[model samples]
Target: MSVHFKKKAANAQTAIPTASLPDIIFMLLIFFMVTTVLRETTVQVRTILPQAEAIEKIEQKRLVTYVYIGPKKLQNNQVGETAIQIDDALVDEVTNVRTIMYNKLTEQPRLIVSLRVDESSEMGKVIDVQQELREAGTLRINYSSKRDIEGTL
Candidate 1:
């Protein structure tokens, strides 16, 4: 008896199509470009920030209120030294600051108010501001400062 032997079929090759990969990447890039929100930097008066040894990292959700101190020039054309300006205006009293802060706190109770005072600013003024914030019911206050080498608070 003669038996016919069939040749083993060649190994089947499976090809994966990668032509859609570029298209998928392009679509994702376009989606991110269209949906991404660009954050604008906050504006404030320039001041030399104080340095600290230990500092805490601020969360993104915290609300920041900037208070600037600079000089107030006289209307008679006399230039004065730098002074504090709260919201672009001179801080006449803690009440004014408290009023504004109170309004802001009312809108956002979990506000983490950050104080970025200049190194030369009077401690009394800074403490007053903090006191005002405390009176206004803003308990979460952060003092922003540059980190020193020793990492002391």
Candidate 2:
């Protein structure tokens, strides 16, 4: 005995429904919107980071806090002087750095302070920041720098 398939429908629907696509796209948009971390604070300070022979990429972005130290970017470089910036605020006194960093450390115990120091900035300022960090007990620090290329084509 032989079996045969029947195909005798003339008005049957054959096209796939397109109604769910917009909902799917909307869901994806919402998913990405929630997952992405928007940059809340803009880096207002001008820091020309020094060069280094070796460098490593940070694995965790959330575990890092940036401390900007440089000659304040102003209309005239001569008028404005070197300053320390934490988060979005400028620290008028160096002593405030320790308190701020200590608070941050309490919030995030594994936080690594990344110091972005300018190449032309005075070394004394950096030493001061380091001393503050040491007092704050934020010893796990990383110096942000560019890769040195002396004799490269």
Candidate 3:
């Protein structure tokens, strides 16, 4: 009795084709390039934001509307009173805050009002703004602050 072992012939090309790899990569690149969006928030007011040890990152900027609550930027090195800036206009009266904020809420239902209040700002002003926001049914508010300093001692 004779035992015979036969070997199978190998093909010239690979079993899996990689010819479409560049095409697939190109499509993916175009997909991400088109889907990527950059949102910009322009602040026209002078704000000296308070410092905080703990801070939360905002994931979606489209849902946020910045309300700068700080001292007014005056010329000739003069110190100005605390005021609120909505978009590009400097609104002196707290009463006007609601209408603007309400309008924003109408545009974006899930709007987050971020208060960039100064460290030296009066708590009363901040509270008043909060009250107005509450009246406008904008309960989603965020306080913007810088990272707190660490002590050597």
Candidate 4:
């Protein structure tokens, strides 16, 4: 009689399991879709844009900052005195625009200030805002205006 010994080699897996890959990708996609926010601010000022002879569209909205200059909206659908609004807050002083715009410029280096002035608003307010923007070192500006329908017709 002879004694026999046998050795068994252990089997191991080298490839990564991709069985739950689709499930994980779908979960991540749903998470981002739910968490993302589009527009946050409610426009406090009313801006009935001025009509222009020629209008150019802005494709990159992220690079643009809107400055609203128009009559403040009061209760009972009444319009108050001419007011300046930056984002959601109403600007109190014209000189403060310099600091506000300077802060915005720091956040976005290539900031394009879009003046959405009301058709009825005075030029002096617009000029003041422009001067402040110049002091803030944000020279690239775009005046937002609607296309003239009467002229086209």
Model 2 regions more than 4 Å off: 1-35, 76-79, 148-153
The alpha-carbon deviation from the true structure for residue 115 of candidate 1, after best TM-score superposition, in angstroms, is: 0.4
Cα lDDT tens digits, model 2, 70-151, are 8777765542688899989889999999999999999999989999988888889999999999999999999999888793
The candidate with the higher lDDT, 2 or 4, is 4
For each candidate, how many residue pairs have backbone atoms clashing (under 3 Å)?
13, 0, 0, 0
Residue 16, model 3: Cα distance from true site in angstroms: 25
Root mean square deviation (Cα) for candidate 2: 4.3
TM-score of 4: 0.73
Candidate 2 lDDT trough over 10 residues, lowest sum: 1-10
Best candidate, TM-score:
2
lDDT of 1 by residue, 1-153 (tens): 234576667888778789999999999999999777565443234456888866888755446666664344565655455555655556666677788888988898777887766676668777777788888888887777887866554
What's the lDDT for residue 136 in model 1? 85
TM-score of each candidate? Answer: 0.60, 0.74, 0.69, 0.73
Residue 138 miss distance in model 2 (angstroms)? 0.6
What are the C-alpha RMSDs, in order, of all predicted structures?
6.9, 4.3, 5.4, 9.2
Clashing pairs in 2: none
lDDT of 4 by residue, 1-153 (tens): 233455446678788999999999999999999777588677777789989887789877888998999999988998999999898899999999999999999999999999999988989999999999999999999999988888955
| lDDT score of residue 64 within candidate 3 | 84
* Model 1 per-residue lDDT at 64: 64
| RMSD value for candidate 3 | 5.4
Off by over 4 Å in 4: 1-37
